[model samples]
Target: MMRKTLTYFLTLFLVIACSTVPITERKRVNIVDDAEILPASFAQYDTFLKENKLSTNKEKTQEIREIGQRISKSVDRFMRANGMIEEANQYKWEFNLVEDEQMNAWCLPGGKVVFYTGILPVCANEDGIAAVMGHEIAHAFAKHGQERMTSSYGQQLGGVAVALGTSGQDYETQVLWNSIYGISSQVGMLAYSRTHEKEADKLGMVFMIMAGYDPEESIDLWKRMKADSKGGAPPEFLSTHPSHDTRIADLQRYLPVARMNAREYGIDE
Candidate 1:
């Protein structure tokens, strides 16, 4: 009975979970839709703002807003030109500078963005900020977060299958199978995260160039990011994010293609 249940869910997953990413056309396994996720995301964003302090640095705050607006406009143009107008319209487009020292930034679904002060020195200037924001925005544009959730559910379902399949086994054997499932699922999740990060880098660079930022600046931004990490990051296989060197190299390789994409929007590098 458990085997039959597993087969049914697996079949349904195969049937309904395939989606193509907008810009890159990369196929992803994601069953969740925007309508299902955005309401919760917006609420979460509002709650985050209420709970955290907004940055008081007027100059830096203005810079973040300006850069975000430019990239948001460019992203709109790209989506419209590519027949994603409905998707573009769904974005509310808010940018905020939060008072935090972590070198981090993220764009929630529906285009809510928050940047930390600690990342500012690394950004160095408006173009550098664009580089960072562009990458972060691309994560939203690509719906990587929703894909990640769907993947997590898929992994959890695998765990259920293991539990059910081993119901008749000795305790030690079930423990062994569960352990194997846990490790394999974690590794798969890490791989999915790394792929999303790399794709975001490529799409972000293109978006930044389309918004009139220098594509070459993205490599510099990643170099700063690497230097900022100080070689203290976890090894690539176990980490959700790629190593700084890997990201820098990927950005360098994608530069020409990003420039070509920018030209399609009438922005030449």
Candidate 2:
């Protein structure tokens, strides 16, 4: 049973894994497509806006929109120039500032973005905002969320396989195997998530540079983020995110590469 299950999953993985991200070119499962996902994403975005308080500070709200627009335009231009016009066209960009104080922001697939006022202070100015927004947009642009969904699906399939393989085993043996499988699967997922975060950081820096923002601001932003954490975080290997130190160092190391890539787009900074 284990052999048969493994064979089946391997075949399925081979058949469906084809999509490659734009900048990173990382191979990913094509199990989910934009057409099938965008309607739901858009609906959820609308519902979220309806449920949340939109910021009343007109000046701040305008600034959020302006930063978002500039970053989105830069992304679109880069994608179009790189033979990804169809992918770029699929994005319907919308950015809003919410009144929450959670110091959080996210970009939903298909280019819907929400910035909490709480994070604005962390993103102190236009360049800082570019750093944050660029990172969020990078996650969407690289289709990391879609890849995560695919990975979750694969994990579920793995669980199912384990169940089938252990069906004939003793109760104690079954429990042990199941526990091991669950732990390994969780660890794999966490590793996958960390990789995605690192990829976003790199791509975000590139986008920010191309958008005419200083890539160095990325390091500064992460430093601010680390200070905000108050030195409290799980070890890097155990967390879904790299340690703040790791992120800062990575951004500092990659800033030069990002700037060099920007030159290709005629953005020499």
Candidate 3:
């Protein structure tokens, strides 16, 4: 009876929570509320800015901000056109450049973005920056973080369901079931993260192109990323991100589609 009830509730929850991602139209189950997560995200972003040193190079910092503004405005236009104005308005978009030596950049929910100085060289130029910027913004735009939190909660609930379902089983059988669940859940999450990464890549290219940036630069950017890694990246099956080689190939294949979609929006460039 408990198992049946759990199954019924889980199905109901999934049905209620399902949503389609913008651009990609992929269906996802996200139980986390923007109202619940955005305030915390804003607070954390504030704390991070207060703790980090802003870049001293005025020219580069201004460049990053300019590119961010263009890309973000394009994204805003897209959301509003698609009748996602409320979601678009919720974004308090801000971009920053930090004085750090890590080739990293990220966007927190609600459109807070940061770029480390070390990545500038990898970015190589304005086009490169747009490639990275669009990708990071896509993460926020898609609400990947919130989706991940929802998935984590689902995993915990699944664990509880497993415990309840196995209460009648012998100790050894329960242990085996849990062991299988643990391994499978971890791998499942890694795969989920990779999917998010790829989706971001595709969405980013479209956003960049819509903003009149070259979508093909994204391919070159990934090629540089591949060369920079020097073959040290983990195997794709075990990593949270697709391998650089995989990304470069994927970008190549998707460029034509991205350009076509951009043209539909009247972006001839």
Best-performing candidate as measured by lDDT: 3
lDDT-wise, the better of 1 and 2 is: 1
Q: Which residue segments of model 2 deviate by more than 4 Å?
A: 266-269
Cα lDDT tens digits, model 1, 46-133, are 9999999999999889989999999989888878887999999888889999999998999998899999998999999888999999
Q: What is the lDDT, from 0 to 100, of the residue 161 in candidate 3? A: 95
| lDDT, candidate 3, at 263 | 74
What C-alpha lDDT values do all the predictions have?
0.88, 0.86, 0.93
Would you give me the overall lDDT of model 3? 0.93
lDDT of 3 by residue, 231-260 (tens): 999989999999998999999999988988
RMSD versus native structure for model 2: 1.8
lDDT of 2 by residue, 1-269 (tens): 56786878768785868677766667767577889888899999999999999999999999889888888898898888889899899999999999998989998989999999999888887889999999999988988778788788778877887887888999999999999998998888899989889988998888888888877888898899999989899888889999999999988888877887778764523
State TM-scores per candidate.
0.94, 0.94, 0.98
Q: Point out where model 1 deviates above 4 Å.
A: 265-269
